[model samples]
Target: MYKRALPPAHYSLKIQSFSLLSKSNVDKYDSGVFEVGGYKWSLSLYPNGDKDNNGSGFVSFYLSIEETDKLPHGWEVDVNYKLFVYDKIRDVYLTIQDADGAVRSFHDLKTQWGFVDA
Candidate 1:
């Protein structure tokens, strides 16, 4: 994974799972857990709310990694990860490509959402 600048803010992101099966194949997925590169990152997916489909299912997700830092201010970090989805047609994991088809840096993902002095 490589770090790419996004205007001014950036985050560490990479393929955490491949061919993930959630069981519930609703038209959309709203909530679920994501395992990224061996680490479990909580995800909040809002594919459709009650207003749309009686409050159920989702198509996409907004990923947020739990993290904490101590270097003061927003410090840059090293990120190496790959993100992918299961390709049912090929029976294999298909790599999700970004606009440039490269690992994206959404923010400093090296830190955890824990006490800094702990």
Candidate 2:
């Protein structure tokens, strides 16, 4: 079991306008693509949670692979990711992640993974 004392990599996302990300306004919002371990990835935000998953009255976030068309069929990637939300009142980042160092698989069929209860 690989226990990450801290994330091997991290990305900070800033949302300038909260209202613009609401589910009623937009289905989802995607952060610009980034590279981790040489794989293209992005952060997807569902401000109103994922409707299909009963993610309402809460924020939903996901990590997804990009440029899948460039990858070979059946190719998959395993990754460990953490999501953070900044608390203005607390002046700290609230972090949520896999406690046991679980690896999430991203493949052709399922290219994204995340917490809907966030």
Candidate 3:
């Protein structure tokens, strides 16, 4: 599981990737494997906006969570992603802020569409 310094224990999301094509969602995938206090957790990503967005542009994403008590599905409850950003001209650094409000690192992709399964 990937470790992230976020509030609460587990940090998860739904859906994963998209296609950046004409009239296509062009998904930006999020690694489904996440952890909280070292405990394994599940997540999924679902398409929220641009239900039919198939153009080239900055892709948007949100965080959704599901507890172990509930069965996994296409769309879960409790979604969370506090820190986020969208590149205007497309840059090399991926925006990611630490829980302490510090810019430590960045990635090549952004978490846009997907849902986390329980």
Candidate 4:
């Protein structure tokens, strides 16, 4: 984990009136398509935590590849990614990444990667 003044370079998801999600019983919410590294992607947010994945009391966030059907067979993407949460009061971001700083491989078999408790 790290703290910095800059926001995530690849993408960011900001939810206004976030409290309404829990009030409305939205278990999961997916953001619209966004492009990165020539591939389409989206953010999956579990505002009230994903109970199925063992995220009962914490927020679960994930990055999902989109439009994978368009990619070639056996396609894969190597990504060194980081997730961030902005602290409005502090004016900084709390960033989280793999401890080993490894490049994660995304392929047909696995299209999502993220923190179960974010």
Alpha-carbon runs more than 4 Å astray in model 1: 1-58, 69-71, 78-81, 88-90, 108-118
Candidate 4 structure lDDT = 0.83
Off by over 4 Å in 4: 1-9
Using lDDT as the measure, name the better of candidate 2 and candidate 4: 4
Superposed on all Cα atoms, model 3 deviates from the true structure by an RMSD in Å of 11.4
Q: TM-score for all predictions?
A: 0.35, 0.82, 0.29, 0.83
Error of 2 at 59 (Å): 0.3
Model 3 residue 109 distance off true place after TM-score fit, in angstroms: 30
Model 4, residue pairs in steric clash: none
Please give the lDDT score at residue 60 for candidate 2.
88
Q: Regarding TM-score, does 2 or 3 come out ahead?
A: 2
lDDT of 2 by residue, 8-33 (tens): 87777898757655725786888989
Candidate 1 per-residue lDDT, tens place, 1-118, comes to 4444532332333333323433434333423445444334554433233234344442344444544243336754333333354555678975433445443344465432211110
Candidate 3 backbone overlaps, count: 32
Query: What CA RMSD would you report for each candidate?
Result: 11.1, 3.0, 11.4, 5.0
| TM-score winner | 4
State the lDDT of candidate 3 residue by residue for 5-114, as single tens digits.
55554343322223333235534334464655433343322223334444223344434222433433343223233433333347443554334443222111322323
Q: What would the per-residue lDDT of candidate 4 be over residues 1-118, giving only the tens digit for each residue?
A: 5444544457778877667776777899999999977899998888878899999988888888899999999999877788888866678988877788777789999999987887
Alpha-carbon shift of residue 13 in model 1 (angstroms): 15
Whole-model lDDT per candidate: 0.39, 0.83, 0.35, 0.83
